[model samples]
Target: MVNKLPLSGETVIFTSTKKSEEPYELVRQLGGNPVSYPLIRTEERVSVNDDERMMQTRNYDWLIFTSQSAVAAFHHKLKRFKMDVQDYELRVAAVGEKTAHALERIGFRVDFIPDVFSADVFVRQFNPEGESLRALFIKGNLAGTLISTELSLSVDEWTVYETLPEVSSAARIVELVKDTTSVTVLFASPSAVTVFTEHVAPKIGWAGYTIGAIGHITKRALHRMGAPVHVMPETYTLPELVQTLAGSKGRN
Candidate 1:
């Protein structure tokens, strides 16, 4: 007699900018058939003044990172410019643990992380001093202005990457979601949620499937589109989302 895995026989769908291996492997480990139906793609932005922008970080007191992609793009620019992060006298604040880990991997010492991993929560909790600190926020093009608007600091934003919808994947998404009885679709970003609602939901009509969102923003996006969100973890991370789904046995 073998014990049944938590996500046994469930078809888990990942709809994000990129298909990450960690969460896919986790879903597979729990006996789910994981599918990568990316609804969005990210591209790093390049500029002629990349060197000047990279050098500008030295003047900021804090380097704020909201996503792992931003960290990756930042690191890539640093490497291209042959600049070492350690040489800059800047404190770093990450919106979540994953972003912090990504920064740490690239030799940055993360000084702050919000209790909750959302931009609104981050704005409320970060920089208690209100001492007119200057921060450079490295982010994707579609990121919200909440952080820049709410933070009582001299905040400047640099668009390192842009998130674009993978409109070509619409047919594949519809095909994979055809059998919805054992399917669990997970969305990571609001941008992906927007893409799905616009392109895929029109075909499938937003029913007969289990839906999971990574953060409040994504959940809100799904709700605004009249899609029912079945599962949302307390923590806004992929591992937590997978664990939450597994613990629930992939059910509503």
Candidate 2:
């Protein structure tokens, strides 16, 4: 027999620029209302410097992808620059399963995925040796220097995309979230957390809301911003995050 869904009458607010199907569908399956309040918007970075940096990817030994958006933006740039994916003899390293899957969907094989889905863990486990291990990180504008700072390898980065706060104003975001009685705010990255804390937290505190994070890194971001985390999945995936939140105490 099929099991009954727990989030039958609950509401979940997800913060992401692009539309994601898994979490939204899961909320509907569990009979919960899914609200997409995208607080972060990502766009490609176009410049002569960006183009020149992208052309230099072939010289790097490893290409590091931090997010799915980076993978998509990178592929889009590749076609625009007329660079064949196969022409770059570089191994791929992804920070999380979703990033790896995004690369796989585009026919790129990910050679390395850290045990933990965090940049700190990824860099520690990278184990770069010798001077020949040149690394290139394709990341967004809001990415921290932690990965490049921690990695022992000679690393260069290209800002393939930039993340902007999308709510327009704090008053607008506060108005959107004020009516959510049984609210659960889902965060996918540190950037989203930053955007929320800077834009929304001041207007409406986390008084009657629960916070859900995709991974420990995001959970830490919530903690750093003084937001309480009510649910965090063991695995950093949208499906797992939704399932965990559905099973949270008092959420039903």
Candidate 3:
């Protein structure tokens, strides 16, 4: 028999620019009304107008991918730049499991994966030694500085993808919250939190709402925007955040 989740009747909003399916389904399985609103728009950076220098060579020691979006954007660039995925002879290091999975989907093998998903932790344990250990990271405009300064290897990061505010989804988010009472909004990244403020404008009407942040940076953004964090989970995973919020609601 299937178990019932405790979050029945609760409405939780998710912010993911890439139209995530798994996380949203997980939320629905838990009996929560999960709504996804993409906050950032992404596009491939490689183009006819792109710098010839940037597209010149794919030789690198390691290819680091931080998010699944980076993976998607990188592959798109590969198609446009006429890059041979096999031409780049380098090890793969991914910060998150999802990112690694995305690469795997494209038949790429990742050699270095850490237990923790955070960029800071990945840098600490990364052992990018050897002559072919120099690294190149395919990342977004809002990537953290950890990539450019890999503690173990010579690292360089290129903004292969850029993120912009998704105004339409943002506006729809505001509309959802306007009708729903006491909604719990989940911010997955700093960009999501940053865009939320502008997209929603006067806020998500936290008058009867709660906020949930996926990470520390997102927490800071919500507080900066005057949203009270009713629940900040110990972990940043989607399941953990949902469980934490549901548990907190029951406790109160």
Q: Output the number of the lDDT-best candidate.
A: 1
Candidate with the larger TM-score of 1 and 3:
1
TM-score rank order: 1, 2, 3
Runs in model 1 deviating more than 4 A are 1-4, 128-130, 250-252
Q: Write one digit per residue (lDDT tens) for candidate 2, span 1-252.
A: 334677766787788764468789989888788877788888887887767777788888999998998998998988887887778777899998889989988778899999888888887898755776889888999888987788888888788888888866445557756865666778888888887888789889866787899888888888988888989998888888889887883343
Model 3 Cα lDDT, one tens digit per residue, 38-134: 7877876665655463464366767888888888877776676677677766678887667888899876899988766778778788876676466
Task: List ranges where model 3 is wrong by over 4 Å.
Answer: 1-3, 49-57, 81-84, 201-207, 232-235, 250-252
Question: Cα deviation of 191 in candidate 1 (Å)?
Answer: 0.2
Top TM-score: which candidate number?
A: 1
Local accuracy by lDDT, each model: 0.89, 0.82, 0.74
TM-scores for all candidates? 0.95, 0.91, 0.85
In model 1, pairs of residues that clash are none
Q: How accurate is candidate 3 locally (lDDT)?
A: 0.74
Local accuracy of candidate 1 as per-residue lDDT tens digits, 112-145 = 9999999999999986464778999999999999
TM-score, structure 1 vs. true: 0.95
238: Cα error in model 1, Å? 0.9
